[model samples]
Structure formats: structure tokens, C-alpha cells
Target: MGQQTVNEPPVVEGPATQEFAPEVEKLINTVAKFTVLVSQKLPDDVAARLKELAEEETAPMAKMIYSTMARNQDLAWQLKRPSCQDTGLVQLFVRAGTDFPYLDRVDAAMKEAVARATKWSPLRLNTVETFDEYNTGTNTGSRSPWIYWQTIPDSDSLELDVYLAGGGCSLPGQGKTLMPGEGYEAAVKFVLDVMTSYGINACPPLLVGVGIGSSIDAAAYMSKAALMRPVGSHSANPKAAELETELKDAIDRIGLGPQGLGGQHSVMGVNIENSARHPSVLSVAVNTGCWSHRRGTIRIASDLSYELLTHKGVEL
Candidate 1:
């Protein structure tokens, strides 16, 4: 949440004053360890979705592929290793109250976590300079391992949505701004266009995120953010939920299946996140998340009590 926030909600500071300075360092170290744990383990929600999708698939080859995906996940857990060879990119979506004692340390905590995770989880060396093309090896660099933040007013907890943005899925991301006359129909058409044009390579069944807002960048950011949400959770708005259902159905009909092999369902789910739009412009963006769909959410309370929402019963 570097600075993609639209307009931050009002936050009232709590007891995180000068007396808590020592606690800040501890919190950073805690977050760093949590990052390593997240990197190597597949979240339960993703595993459940894969199981559900596998059951729905009727094609022999597709079913076999899903079985293999499940086996890979099993082996990763059994061996306590990364599920994929290309760990891809790390992106953390954070929600924290301004009053949290460790607020100042959040950014550093995240960076330190990424660096530590590279060696601990043994993550792939994904950060390279833009033009120079030299690997940083540690996955920490200028704007690398991006973190998105949203502040929750009157709260004293840090909630993190950690995601491994695999390169295969990110390759198909695209955004566009439709003119006033284009209407919502045009937005759906654009999503369909993206799926047909590029979804196969990303390794379906995909979790499709569709973002609609006032501008391309805004929508693009939301689209990526949407992926961080729980896989099957839809927007609260009825219209938005309907759009999500329609998009999921339509995209699944594309039959990209597991690893792009033809089958009954192409996508596991389609999630739409939207905000008020400028009357003259309807900006939309689409992001695909592959079957692995590695994302997890963890929350740490002011009292230091912790919970892993996506991975139940996890102490960290």
C-alpha cells in the first residue's frame, strides 16, 4: 500500500506512543518471520478451490492435471518447500490502523521480511534492475516486492494479505478506459477479449479480478487488489455481485481448464472490485491469478494475539 490509496479513511491514534519503541522492533521481526512462512505454504482457500475445481472437471487430461497440482501442493507441504519453481513476485496488501504501535516500522518490516524470506524460504531471485538487468538476489530493490496499504479507522490491529504474484498470470494483465458511450457492456467485452487473447498461458482455472473505476491506473490497481481478496468472495453491492457471477460463468465457459487444457470450467472464480467512476469515463482492468493462487491473510492484534484467517489454526 505504498501510495495507491484513493483517499485514506480518518484514523484516530491509540496507545502506540514513544513507550512502544522497543515493541516496534519485535513487531518487525515477527512480520519478517510470518512472510517466510507465507512464502512456502499454500493458503487453505486456494487448496480448497483447486479441490472444488478438480471435482467439477470431467476431462481426463484436465482432471489428471488437477491431480498433479494437488500432488505438487502435497509434496510442497510434505517437504516444507515452495510449491512452484518460479516463486515470482511478492506483493503484500496491508490494512492497519494509524495508531498501531509498529506503524512506523511497517515498511521496513516488509522489506526486511522479503530479504529474509529469499534465503529462508529460498525464494527465486526476482528483482532485477530495469535497464541494467542485474539481479538484486535479495528480492529487495527500487519499488520491488510492492506493498499496498489501506488504513482502518479506530482499529489497533495490522491485517496483511500476502500474495505471491506468479509471472505466468501477471503476464496477461491489462487495463483500458472506455468512453462514455461504451457502457458496462463494453467492459464485459473487454474482459472477454482479455481472456480469449491471453488467459490460456496463465494456467487456468484462473481467479479473474475485474476492476472498474474512474481511470485506467485506478482500475488496474484495484484489479490487482481484487486478487488479494478471498477467492470466492464477491462485492457487497448486488449489481457488482451479479457482474462477478456473470463474468465467472462466462470466463469458465472458455474452457481453458487446468493448465489451459480444455475442460468444463476455465476459471475458479471472477471477482469484481469497483469504485465511483467519472461520468465520462469507465475504466476497467483485468488480472488473472493461476490455479496455485498463492495468497494468505494474517492479523495481529494490539495485545499481540494473532490469527491466520486464510489458513485456519495456524499460530502465526
Candidate 2:
């Protein structure tokens, strides 16, 4: 990210602004623009990884598909439209500092931002009520634009990992509890089984996220969070990093290639995030991001200055 300072004057001019209404409006606009940006352009790491995969692909048909994907992205940028028709269900992974002045307002601001983005980006209406089963049309519904939060201690910044969880990629996500006796090897097996069975449906080369933890819910959350990491990054834990490499190599060997038609690679990379679990319990979850990997990270400082950590040389 370029870390450029926003030069626009504050949306409101006043000294008695304790409510921070001006800041909220600015945040809403910034997030709305970011939503659109990610829809049209892949993150820097994802874009680079795709190019690498395209070069490594040797199958004639797969290579052609890769070229088509490249052209699709180019057209998306040129036309300033969504690269994929399913712009996806909006999700924000929030890491908000406890000291952040606007903590209480973040939720409303983000929801409003999504509403604005829906119209501005012309985002596909993907939110539907569960069970009741009706599309909201506005891309907002009960519990839609799901926001996952983590509070930071003794800090004053807000960071967000925004993701467009498309239906294809969402279809392959799975989590299950394994007996401790089955061991980590079983976890590996679970990942392989899921990908081998459903990877094609996700539109490879995928960015596979694996989470191991004490409970299914924890594992599922971590699995999705892992997708927010840069494409080729590895876990800090040596064992986890090794698992990542092993899984990545195994998935690549599957030969799903571009659009899963068949070729040399099935995934951009594998990321493993783990949490210590009760001795009796082992839970593992797998989540995948399709090749487009529509996601971005932004860090906003106390004064509301921001950095787009994933898309360098870009501004909202």
C-alpha cells in the first residue's frame, strides 16, 4: 500500500465535534470506494501469484484459460466494473483498537458503507434471508455484511480485512471435529479430501486456508481469517508453516489448474492458522478463496489517515 495521506478537507468543520459525525461520513465513503476497488482489481499479491501460476501452467488449454482470466481482469479495470458477476456477500474482519474513538459507530458506518457501495459499485444483489429465503436486493439483510471483530489493546487504530465471499468459494468451505487420536495427519487428510472433491467448484488456483483449533467454530473463523493473509505468506509457527507447504504442494499436484479444466497447479498457496486446543479435542476447518480472491486490508490511524495495505499505488 502506498500509505498516501487523504488530502480532502474534513467532511464537517467544527471544534465541538465530539460525536465524530464527520469522521463517520469519511469512513463510510472510504469503505464504499474500497469495496468497489476490490471488486474490480485483485490485491497485489493475488495478482502476482496469478501471473506466476499462468507462467507455470504448461497445458495448452489451461494456458489459454489463464490468458483469458488475465484479459478479464484487464477489462474489469478498463471498464471500472466488477471482474466477476458474483460480487459476493460482504464480510469485514475488523481489528479495532480499544482506544479508537469511533468504536461504537464502526458497525453502523460499515453497514451504511456497504449500502452505498451496493449502489456505487453496482454490486450484485447477493444477500438473501436464510430460511425465509428472499434476496434483499439491496445486498443487506439480517446478519448480512457479516462483521467479525477483534479488539486491540492500548492502541488507537482500526484495521479491516474486507472480503467478497462469492458463492463458488463459499460452497467448498467445511469444518469438522476430529478425535485427538486421529492426529494432525487426519487434519491434513480432511483438507485433501475437501479439495479433491470440491476444488473444481471453487475455480482454482485457490488460496486454501486451513484452521486447526479446539472447536469447530474457532477453526472455521481462523480458516476464513487465514485467507486474509498475503498469498504466499507462511505461518510463524514452524510446524504450521511446514503443514502449509505440504498442503500447498499436495493441492498443486491435484492438477485442477485454471478454472479446474486441468493443468499443473490447483492452488496459489496454502495458509495454516492454528490455536492450542484441549487435549481431548481437535477441530479443523478449510476455507478457500477463488483465483480472483476479492479482498483488501486497510489500516486507519487515530487521525483517520489510512493505508491500503494490500493494493499498492491505489487510493479510494
Residue 55, model 2, lDDT: 92
Cα deviation at 309, candidate 1, in Å, is 0.8
lDDT (Cα, tens digit) per residue for candidate 1, span 217-293 = 99999999888878789899899999999988888888787888799888878888899988899999999888888
Best by lDDT: 2
- In terms of TM-score, the best-performing candidate is 2
Off by over 4 Å in 2: 1-20
Q: What is the lDDT of residue 46 in candidate 2?
A: 96
lDDT of predicted model 1: 0.82
